[model samples]
Target: MKAVKWFAPHDMRLVEVPKPAPKPHEALIRIESTGVCGSDMHYYTDGRIGKTIITEPLILGHEYAGIVESVGADANPALVGKRVAVEPGIPCLKCEHCLRGRYNVCTTLQFPGGPPYDGALAEYSAVHAAFCFPVPDAITAAEAAMIEPLAVALHTIELAHLMPGETVAILGLGPIGLLTAQVARLAGAGRILGTDLLGYRVDVAKRYGVDAAYNAQTIDSVETILRETNGRGVDLAIDCARSTLTPAIACRVARPAGRCILTGISGEEYGQFPVDIARRKELTITWCRRFRFNFQTAIDLVASGRIDVRSLITHSFPLEQSRDAFELVSRAGENVLKTSVDQ
Candidate 1:
């Protein structure tokens, strides 16, 4: 099998390794496509995100889709030949969190494409069969690979406890942020406002159902959103920028008692926000980790055409050109939203 492995900062190589076989409850998949995620870029560019450092050669991809080439003895034989979107994180079902259906936060969770677990940036991957969600023929391989991020967005919306006709402000127009805005819109958010430092991203957000998109570099995003909301701010604010400033801005732009959700992965170990403003507003702040039990919903949303993720896939590269894919996403150039590696 051929895989892309990270050795050091800005260093990734295509190497040959033994193909893996499925365990008793697993399936061996021939990887068809893999999305280059923000976390992949963080590892490729900075060699780390907080304390999760690349201390060893690690394959760097997680959001992926593939065909079930074979199944283990105990795995479902019917899954063979099916195209599936893989949920990359495997949680320890024995943990309290997992027992309560909150497996995304399981203390002993095993996530691929990080330090220890190799990811699906290769021709093949063997994953637990239960985590592989089958998609209808209507979903393309690229779209299937996107279900992971869509799941994250869905989880964030769920955490927000969004309601019909409530206003929402999404602070960031990256792939996740744009998807979050779309999900919020479909959830019946009255008005969806999106912001990003880049104008192109703002423009992209507008096309994806945001009522208004603002470039924070050009104007005060919090103030603008408040002004449009009659100085009361939005009913819900979600920060997907992972920047130190956006969470605080989310706190500022949320109405009194409004809910705020943080879904971005911060580079810094500790983030400081405007606690005073948050306290005064009596805000209900929540943090979102990777999705839990949302992959099926995400697939259904995309498969049913309720959410359009195809447009967000601005670039695609072959598995052999994985390095270029990482570079394109890392530089955030060419108005790229999501970059995927086709196998």
Candidate 2:
């Protein structure tokens, strides 16, 4: 088996390794495609996010799809040959959070390509059967690989409690932001606006049917949004860029009583905010965690044609070119939306 391993900052190697064996409740899958995520790029460039440092060599991919090659003795034989999109995180079922259906907050969660567990960056991966949802025949492996990110988007929108006919302003146009825009539209948001520094990303959002797109770096986002919304501001603002300036701007661009959902990954020791301004406007703010049981919903959305993630894949590299794939995603420019590694 071949895998992409991260040993240190900006250091990754594609090396041969032994294939994994599935446990009694798990399935051994022959991975077909894996997507390089923003978190993976963070680990590749900085060796860590916050205090979670990469002290040991680790496989670095989580967004993936595969075919079941073998199942545990206790597992159903019918699972064999089934194509699946892996959920990537396995929380301890014994935890209260897990029992309460909030497993995304489980204290002892094992998340692939995260702090400790290896991810699905190899030819084969052993995942819990329950965490691997069967990909419908209509969904291609490339689209299946995007289900992970789509789940993140779905979870964020759910957290926001978005309502029909609401307007939203997204402060990023990466995969997460682009997917969130589509999900918001599906949730019946009246007007979906997306912003990014890259022209290509804005173009991508436009292709996805966004009502408006902006270049945050070239234009004044808050001013433009206010004008577009007739000075009432948007009903919701989602900061998916993890940019320090984004959250503050979100507060400014949001309506007086609107909600702001911060879905980006930020490890800042302290987030400086315009407390007085937010308090004056009485804005509601929420932070998004990974996801809770949204994988199946994400797959169904794509399978039913409500979400089109197939266009999100802008680059693909075979297992032998895994290094190149990682680099392309790590240095994603205007042209790259998502990059995948294929087996």
Candidate 3:
């Protein structure tokens, strides 16, 4: 088998490796496609995201889809020969967080591609059968690889508690941000705005059905959005960029009694916030983590053509060229919304 391994920062290599056999209660999936995520780029370029450093060689993919080739003796035979979306995080079901339906925050969660565990950027991977969700025949493997990010988008909209006919502003036009914009529209948001520093991304957002897309570096985002909304501000603001000024900007551009959803991870421990503004406006703040139980919904949306995940997938590479794919994502190259490695 072949695998993409990140030995260290700026040091990923495609090496021949042994095929992994499924353990009891597990299934071995032959990976078809694996999406390169923002966190994957962060780990590739800097070797870490905040305190979670990659101190050892690790497989660098979690947004993946594949076909089940074999199942362990203890695994359900029904899972074999199914096309599935791989859920990368496995939590300790006994934890308080898990019990509360917040398993993404489980204290003992082991997330693939983050640190200690190997991930799905391989010809074949063995994962717990419970985490694998069968994909309908209507969705292609490339589309299924993106279900992970779409799941994040779905989770973000759920966190914001967006109401039908309400307006929304998504701050960032990256893969997750743009996907969130589309999901918000699907969720019945009346108006959707997406912002990014890149003009290409802004243009892409518009093509993806965003009502408006703004270049934050060239325009006063808050003012432009306010003017467009007749000075009432948006009813909801979702920050998909981990900018230091995003939270305050979100507050400034949102209406009183509006909601703000933060989906991106920041390098800094504490970001500056306009507490006074939030207090005066009575804004609701919501935080998002990796998706929880949203994959099936994402699959449903993709299968039904309600959410077009294909528009977000702009680049694909063979597993042997995985380094090039990572470089393109890390550098934010042109037309590269999401890069997937095909095994």
Best by lDDT: 1
Compared with the true structure, model 3 gives a TM-score of: 0.96
The TM-score of candidate 2 is 0.96
For residues 1-343, could you state the per-residue lDDT of candidate 2 as single tens digits?
A: 9888888776778898999999999999999999988878778888787787778899989999999999998877788999999998899999888899889889899988886888878899998888889988888887899999999999999988999999999998999999998899889899988888888787768777589999887889989999999999999999998567788888998999899999987555456677887898999999888788899999999989889899889898887787787778767753888999887
Distance from true position, residue 154, model 2, in Å? Answer: 1.0
What TM-scores do the predictions have?
0.98, 0.96, 0.96
Candidate with the greatest TM-score versus the true structure? 1
lDDT of 1 by residue, 1-343 (tens): 8999988877889999899989999999999999988878778988888988888899999999999999999999999999999999999989889999999999888899988889989999999999999999999999999999999999999998898999999998999999998899888899998899888998777778899999999999988999999999999999999587888899999999999999988777788889899999999999999898899999999988999999999999998899999988888889899999997
Ranking by lDDT: 1, 3, 2
Query: Which of candidates 1 and 3 is the stronger one according to TM-score?
Result: 1
Q: Can you list the residue pairs that collide in candidate 3?
A: none
Question: How far is each candidate from the true structure, as Cα RMSD in Å?
Answer: 0.9, 1.4, 1.4
